[model samples]
Target: MGILSRILNRRADPPRQTRMLEGASGKRWPSTPAFGATGSEVLAGAAQVRGRARHLRFNDPTAANAAEILRTALVGYGATLTSGAEETDSAFADWAAAVHLGELEGEIIDSLATDGEALIILRTDDRGALRLQHVPAEQLDESYTVELGGGRYIAAGIEYDADDQPIAYHFRPARPTDQYQTFRAPIRVVAADVLHLFRRQGAGQTRGLSWFAPVILPLNELSQLQDALQVTAKIQAMMCGFLIDQNGGATSPLGDGESPLDVSLEPGTMRVLPSGWDVRFTTPQQMAQSVELVAVSLRQIAAGLQMPEFLLSGDMRGVNYSSARTALIQFRR
Candidate 1:
């Protein structure tokens, strides 16, 4: 089955929350410490700009219309409008920072030079203070002026070409992908390993009930299975289907003891006895975890079996025994 279909039918789990670090003030500390890049290495790669705008809706008879008006105003200035109080509230802090920076740039540019275009480079310091740099496009070869507190000024050299004009640099805010490069590496690795194991199982003519069951067997047994198939991996990644024969079609409950012959194994000719029944052993969360574990085993099985690409396509469908008879054959080699 396709990814979406699998995801929809897959058992639900509780939301995952991150572990927080507590501070002396007995509050959870923010992870990133500061808003923007700190050192030169970080600053060197910081090329994009961010802008934000906000509007409040008063308790008027036309509150709906007023909210729409505010949304339009924000969107006109390149803000992605979202729904509800909490949605906007969650986004407000980031939006406020961008708006503040944009305002600071506009004010500083208005103050320093009149003739040429001036771009304000606003960066949040390690202490979360907004640092402003005023750059005149025409005199890019010369040093730009940075505004410190209490009339103190610092001159920083601009790292731009002479021909580089300060155009309206539109900000496309960085996403989760941009912020964290190595974030999803572990999950991807796990998924890949699981896929590999299932592929191996497809190569061997093992008539197992489900992909998960055979993989959960003892390591020695796994080795024997691998040896028997002449493959590197011991487990096969097979899709297990649970279907029940009710009325005209399969009507198997997802859990155990609900129907006879509930479980069906794929890519082989093994038929489950008694046609339909719930194979109950664990909770949904446990089942999900088992699915991942089985996936890992299948990778090993595929490697051991030296399965060809066509056999290891990783397509397992769960349906009633009656419904699957014709469909299962098509997937089987």
Candidate 2:
């Protein structure tokens, strides 16, 4: 092309615009991740995360109470039938009572909070009266995904059609850990026959992650720290420490000039060490007196779960009524 023609083409071209996010540039670029994980990776890792959360729920008071607090706030005392359909209401109440619906609701809430998901298997009695069963959400195997051609597929144990809406669920009748039942094939149930409860956070996400995911690591670390402190407290209480002999004694002062002594002391026991020897009790510091660090971890957990630190830790040291009220009002909203 002629120089004049090229100049005209260059003038017609759009201006160059280079865009780079601050977090994704220069020294930060390599560390700043562009996650390509599947949308349901949360579901994929649910079982292990659920197991840890359940352990905390059963054994850790803070974790257990977190779920309890949520359950109380969300489904306090269950629902009441006050619609004023006297005859119909009474019958509905009776049916609800027969199925223990009130308690069932609370349990379901607990499941969702603690397990990140819940399932209510709808059933009927011999006479065809409706009943409800609350089972572990893990009953639905998230690993059981399959393609069935024509846009019909099972993703995260849920069956979806061309439009990607759930029409059924596949689950194990027995716990996945049950060795005897491990060989049993998954049982498919229509979506209408089950109530799948979960806190959906992302679009096209087929499974729910346990609410504990954000705080699980911190809680576990805190638990370990507290445990270490407890053990340290026990050793500190009894003066259980190692003996350090500065004079390089052949044997422990408490032992004949043979192997080092294995001494056990009780309360109020008076003992003397060799003139050149001293006791260097193996008593470790109580978690470096990390009371504040522990409090900080609890706060992290509370923040992750969106609960008041006072509520989660039961520490009212700095909580005044006004502060608590302000926090709770925001929470209740």
Candidate 3:
């Protein structure tokens, strides 16, 4: 058959059913922001996120407690390396004691949660026994990379083989703000000598982002709300004063007067105002529902933290035993 004749004889395919939003528009999805980020791409913000996370860890009690909670829940008192071979048992004990395994594990977990990754350099003692040196995550900048030609490549400070496996890591000098360090080349360490710990969020992702990424905004909101409420309470408390005119000659402070009379409210002491003088306080009532709102907000943060709300909040008023058990079971898993 000729080409034109064959084309005219082509079969007509039936249309398939499709499903989509019935009436989607900007009004329906007001802000549809999206990020097409790979694992390596996400590390671009890891440094900032890690800095904020660390700041919160130090200055904010809630954040500090959350890190502790995660450490406790995951590592607890840590594990013992006991296989029970005569010499092996003794060697394991010495190594564990030398490294302070329990404390080291907890620190590593905290680093993973706050810094998004734990950079531990493996070293050997004089006897060739293993040793570990924990380095700051900030020492490794994601911008560090080298194209090694062919399929092998160094990306985001990590060197990968042609098979796409990490072969080594390149770490910048300790002091990032130093001009000399900034200009210096990063130190390259083989993957075998370095232990990189992180919880990968996506497949083929080269690096991990802070676990707090999901909850940072919510946490900041909660912190700011609490601060606002605290300031309001303080203002109300400090302004709560009684006006007095012992001689009743000070006149009404609202009208033409020398100055507003200040009266102190002392404990276990009382002072009666003179006649024709009245005390009025500038007390402003705060929102009664603020407590409930905070509780609800904390629950939202708790969801992001992957823990039971009661555990995060220490509020067991509405938490039942069965519910607590279920939540803990899920968290433990």
**C-alpha lDDT score of every prediction, in listed order:** 0.34, 0.82, 0.80
Q: Against the true structure, what is each candidate's TM-score?
A: 0.16, 0.77, 0.79
Residue pairs with backbone atoms closer than 3 Å in model 2 (clashes): 241-281, 241-282, 242-281, 242-282
Per-residue CA lDDT of model 2 for 187-248, tens digit only, reads 99999998888887777667777899999999889899889777867767776777776867
Candidate 3 lDDT trough over 10 residues, lowest sum: 251-260
Q: In candidate 1, what are the lDDT values of residues 1-333, reduced to their tens digit? A: 999999898878877865554442334445435333233322232121100001101221122232233233223333233566777766765755755644543433232211112334554567775555443322222223344444443222222123332212222222344544232211111111111101122222111111122222332343344354433222232323434443444444444664445455447655453445433332234445555554465456444323321223333444356654554354332
Give candidate 1's error at residue 152 in angstroms: 34
Ranking by TM-score: 3, 2, 1
Compute the lDDT for candidate 1.
0.34
Poorest 10 consecutive residues of model 1 by lDDT? 48-57
lDDT of 3: 0.80
Regions of model 2 farther than 4 Å from truth: 1-20, 26-34, 175-180, 240-288
Model 3 lDDT tens row, 1-333: 999998998879867766476445345565775566666457667778888888888887778888888888889777766686778888777778888988998999999888888999999989888888888786765887778989999878889999999999888766535555445578989999999888877777877788888888888888999999999888887876666666757545443443446445678866555466777777565456887889888889888988888878888886789988988887866
- Supply candidate 2's per-residue lDDT for 212: 92
- Estimate the TM-score for candidate 3: 0.79
lDDT score, residue 260, model 1?
44
Off by over 4 Å in 1: 1-90, 93-102, 108-113, 127-132, 135-139, 143-333
